[model samples]
Target: MVKPVNVGIVGCGAISAAYTTTIARLAGLRLTAVADLDAARARATAEANGTRALSVAELLADPDVDIVLNLTIPAAHADVALAAIAAGKDVYGEKPLATTKAEALQVLQAADTAGARLGCAPDTVLGTGVQTARWYVDNGLIGRPVAATAIMNHPGHERWHPNPDFYYTPGGGPLFDMGPYYITALITLLGPVSKVIGAASRTRSERTIVTGPRAGTTVPVTTDSHVTGILIHDSGALSTLVMSFDSAATRAPNIELHGEQATLHLPDPNHFDGEIHAHPVGGTWTSLPTRAGYQDAARGYGLADLTTTPPTQLPRTSAALALHVLDIMESLLTSTTTGQATALTTTCDRPPPVPLGPLEPRTE
Candidate 1:
């Protein structure tokens, strides 16, 4: 029997709970410690999850911690990841990788130099929904891919999130927060992006919180609330993206792929499992069976993938791919400023596909 990887988690916030839950269930991972800037919160989460509570520094240095599960906010992602890499531990974190490409590049450099494996979230792709869709495309169910569309629209996070001020900040907007899932899925299906043209709008300068104890509090909006862009994939496929926090509603499909012979309606990229429907030429839209990816996967599946990947190779949700996603997003925003199609400076090979079944113990 293989010994489970000891995971020390940093940032005991809302997302940490999901990771803790997943770690508990996945056979090859064990939650060993937890840390948060708020000691009380750290202690509470650790006690609840049957782990030790440590200061962030102590957790980083913990001898038992084989991997650092970083759930810190976007602004601190690079800092925490760098610290983990410096301590010679593999690291996985929630996405956007970092607020800016420059910072993200540094994290990538640090990991490469330290020979520490780095991975990032939006592992939702490793689940049945998107993977089944990718399988269809790869299997020629959608013949000769041409164009795609991805849309995500909502009022705003202030309606539900207690501390949503960060959502309006430079690193938070619709594109940064939600674009990763859609764009990453697109890349997985179509291939890497080469250039992009974007147009964006900030519908409101400030927003009022409508939930939690901070209800009625006003927060400044420094980033665009509505973002739309066209990604020119290296394979010559074009993906139209519409991500907006300003919209009250949208009827557009969450994601759709077009080809010479068919059109496919894909499940939401943010979810683990959902129906994938495909419409072939002169045929009715039909559902495709879950054909690829891990079954019943969850948020921390990437951490499981990271810990189990061979030391000589990167994980499917690798830092290289996350950095590429970040570059595409940052380049889109830059295009909004310059009013010209911006060419991407970074590109990554689509990581290997996940086979069906549990990621940890193989089923005979």
Candidate 2:
């Protein structure tokens, strides 16, 4: 049996709640400690979850900790991940693994040197919704996935997120922030990207935060606030991806895979459970069969089939999933700097996506 692992949380922020709740419910995982730059935040998070708070140093130093969930922002993701890996812990963090490809490389290096596993998110792909889509596409139910498209458009999160300034800055653009979920989900349904041709712009020089007490505070945009890209995946599938902070509205599905036979509908990127709808070429929509009661729900990181054979645990988009995403980020950033298409190493590592069984029918 795989031994149960002690888990730690490094950043106490808004998104931290989901990680903590998920960790609490899953077996083979235990929330051993929590930490933050602000001790009070850490304490509050721990208290809410019936746990203890440790300082950043103490949490990393604890021998009992096995997995450190890096809940820090895009800017702090790599640094926190590197520190955790060095301290002999497996790690998974939020996306665009680091601020730049260089920082991401350092994270991979740390994981490699320590022989501790590394990964990052948009774990949403591992959810039942995406996995079911992966199954149908790989099985030729869609008859060769020729292309994909994903779009995320919402006013900035400033009103709700207390520390929203960073999200409007360079490392926090739409592609860097919201792009990971769509990108990671697509890569899961397809495979790694080989190249990206980007054309981006800042529609607005500034955005005013609308949700919080700081609602009226204006934040400057230093990078591309609206990003559009055409990606060629190693799987021979092409994608049109869009992310923006300024769009008042967008009708694009979070993601859709267009294949020779049908189009598959996907769920939102932030959650794991939902319906996977298939629209046949000459027909209409139908729900694909899946494991009963498992819609949108998925296995956590320790469960993804990582070794290329049958996975011992249920299929999950866990830590390994995050690393695959980091590989994509490295290549996207490289293309931005080198002005040349760069291939991701993940193209070589990931096996063809395994297909999901048809959703089983339920009896009254």
Candidate 3:
């Protein structure tokens, strides 16, 4: 029998509930404890999830924790991850890895030196929605891929989140906050990017909070609210990307891939599953059956997947990939400032595709 891997989460913020819920459902993982800078928040999360609450230091030093799930805000991701690695625990965390490429590199280096495995989120690509789309691309159902477009647009999060100040900070802009999903999905389908040309803008200096106790209050915007980029892939595929917090809505599909033979319409990479449509050169649009990825997966499935990875293999959501993704995003932001195309200083192999199945096989 496979013994479940023990998990201790650091950071009991809005995203902690999803990780705790996911751990409860997966057979290969167990939530043993949780921690946060806020003592009360950690205690509350532990009570709700039937686990122990500890200070951030105690949780990292806990012997039972095989992997520390870093769910802290973007600015603090690297610090928490480095601390976990120093404590001799492996780590899996939410997306972007860190606020900057330099910080992400430090986390990767620390993990490498400690001989600890590292992984990061935006694992939605491992789900049926994006994976099914990858299936078509890989099987040549879409022929030689020529180009792709990915877009994520919404009015700012200030209207909904009680604390939306982070969204406007250096690490909270549209590209950093949401670009991981799109860029990671694009890399999964078209391969690593070689270069990028970017442009960005901010709609306002401050945004008023419309909901929550902070309603009617305003937060400063220190980062771009709208960002557009053109990624030149090593495979010779050109992918245009738009990530914006300024737009209220858009009619564009979340993603689309054009090939020699057909065009594929993909569901949102932020979701685990959705419909995929295809249009042949002279044919009408048609739906494709789900053909790959973990069935009914969620946020923590990547951590579960990491738990089962062999010693010689990198997890699908490996930190190397996250670092490369971070480098691309940071470079894009740099391009916006220099008004020049920037070549990526880093790249990673595409992750192994997930076979269509449950995270853990069911027994009859």
Clashes within 3 Å, all models in order: 0, 15, 0
Tens digits of per-residue lDDT, candidate 2, 1-364, equal 4445678889998878877776666555678899999999999999999988999999999998877888887788888988898888877676767887667768877777887666566655655676667777767888988999988887766656755788777678777788878877787777777777666667777767777677777888787777777789877899988887777787878888899889988878666668788999889998877522233334334222221123243223444445556556555655666677666565433434433332222122
Residue 299 accuracy (lDDT) in model 2: 30
TM-score of 3: 0.98
- Shift in Å, residue 104, candidate 3: 1.0
Candidate 3: give its CA RMSD in angstroms. Answer: 1.6
Q: What are the models' TM-scores?
A: 0.98, 0.86, 0.98
lDDT tens digits, residue span 1-364, model 1: 8688889999999989888999999878899999999999999999999889999999998999999999999999999999999999989999979999999999999998998889998899999888888888998988999999999999999999999988899999999999999999999899899999999999899999999999999999999999999999999999999999999998889999999999999888999899999888999988888899899899999889888888788889988899999999999999999999999999999888877787874222
Give the alpha-carbon lDDT of every model.
0.92, 0.71, 0.93
Candidate 3: segments with Cα more than 4 A from true spot: 361-364
- In model 1, how large is the Cα lDDT of residue 163? 93
Q: After TM-score superposition, what is the CA distance of residue 311 in candidate 3 from its true location, in Å?
A: 1.4
| Clashes by residue pair, model 1 | none
In order of lDDT, best first, we have 3, 1, 2
